[model samples]
Target: MPPTRRFRLIPGAVTVLGLLLALGVPAARAHGVRTEVLAGPTSVVTVTHDDGSPLADTPFTVLAPEGAGPFLTGRTDAHGRVAFQPDRPGAWKVRVAGADGHGAVVTVAVDSAALAAPATGATVATHHAHEHDHAHDEAHVHADAHAHDHAHDHDHAHTRDRWSGAIAGLLLLLLVLGVGGVLLRRRRG
Candidate 1:
C-alpha cells in the first residue's frame, strides 16, 4: 500500500512541474513593443522578439483617431522600425501584428494647434481683407465691425466646443474605469 501511494505522488509532482514550466517559459520569453514620436510629424514604432532582437519586416497600420479606418499601412525596416506622419489631429492608433497572431496597439495624441499652424497665414490675409472693406463706406464699416465681432465670437465658441469635447471624453473614461473597478471587486469577493 505504501509503495503505491509513493508512486501516485511522484506522477502528481511531475505533472505539477510540467504545468509550471509550460506556463512560465512563454511568459519569460515574451517580447515588448515600443513607440516614439520623433521631431516634426513623424512617429517611430519598434518591436523586439523574445531574445531582445528586432522583429524586422513586421506589418503595421495606423488609424486616425481611435476606431477609424486605417490611414496608413506598411512594414517595419530591418531595425524593426516604421515611421509615419500623422495627418490629422486627435488620438491616432498604431497597430503592429506578426504572423503568429502576436500584436500591439498604441495610441498617440496629436495637438490641434499643430495642425492649425499652416492656416494662420490665410487667416491673417482674410483679416486684412476685412479691414480693407471696413475703410470703404460708413455703412460698410458698421457691417465690417459687426462681422469682426461675430468672427471673434465664433472663435470663442470653437474653443469652448473643443474644451467640452475633451471634458466629455474624460468623463466617459472615468465612468468606464469606475465600472471596471466595481466589477473586479465583486469578482474577487
Candidate 2:
C-alpha cells in the first residue's frame, strides 16, 4: 500500500459547499422574463427571444378580466408578437408562454383608457406601468389562466416550479445521506 491516507475536509468547507449547491441549483433553472405593451384598442404583448429578436409562431392565449374564458389561442408571428383583443372594456388576462426556452407569461391592461392614452404620455412612460405593471392588472385577473405563460396571471407559476421544488427536496435528502455516510466512515476509522 502507498502512504496512509491523510485526506481531510474541514466542516466549514463542507457547509459552504452544501450552501452553494443549494443556492446554485435554483438560480440555474431561473428563467429570463420580458414584457412589451403596445397601447391601442388591442394591446399586443410581444415576448421576444433572449437575443431581442422575434419569437415566431409560438402558441399563446389570452382571456378576459373575469374567470370565464374559452381562451383565445394565438401564435407569435415572425416578429414574436402576440396581439390580444380584450373581449370587454376592462382589464384583460394576457397569458404568454414560457419554459419552451422563451420566457415568462405576464398580464397587461387593455381598455379604452389604457389604449386611448398613448403609451408615451402621463403614466405608462413615468411608471413604466406597461413594462412592470403587475399592480395595474392583478385585481381583474381571471382564474382560468392559471396554467399559462403570464407569470402574475396564473396561480400555478409553471410546471417547472413544482418539479424544481421536488428536486431541491430530494437533493436535501441526498445531502443528509452523504453526511451520514461520512460520519459512519469517520466512526469506523
Q: Best lDDT goes to which candidate?
A: 1
lDDT of 1 by residue, 1-189 (tens): 599998998889779866875565444444433333321245455455543355678898888775557888989778666566667677777787888887667666666654544421111111011233332211211347775775555345444444455457657976999899999999999
Per-residue C-alpha lDDT of model 2 across residues 83-169, encoded as one tens digit per residue:
655545665655666446565465665556755654332122111222434333322223345413444332133234434665788
lDDT of 1 at 170: 56
User: What TM-score does model 2 achieve against the real structure?
Assistant: 0.43
Q: Candidate 2: how large is its RMSD?
A: 11.7
Task: Please list the Cα RMSD from the true structure of every candidate, rounded to 1 decimal place.
Answer: 20.5, 11.7
Q: What is the C-alpha lDDT of each candidate?
A: 0.56, 0.53
lDDT of candidate 2 at residue 164, scale 0 to 100: 64
* Candidate 1 colliding pairs: none
Please give the distance, in angstroms, between residue 145's alpha carbon in candidate 2 and its true position after superposition.
Answer: 37
Whole-model lDDT for model 2 versus the true structure? 0.53
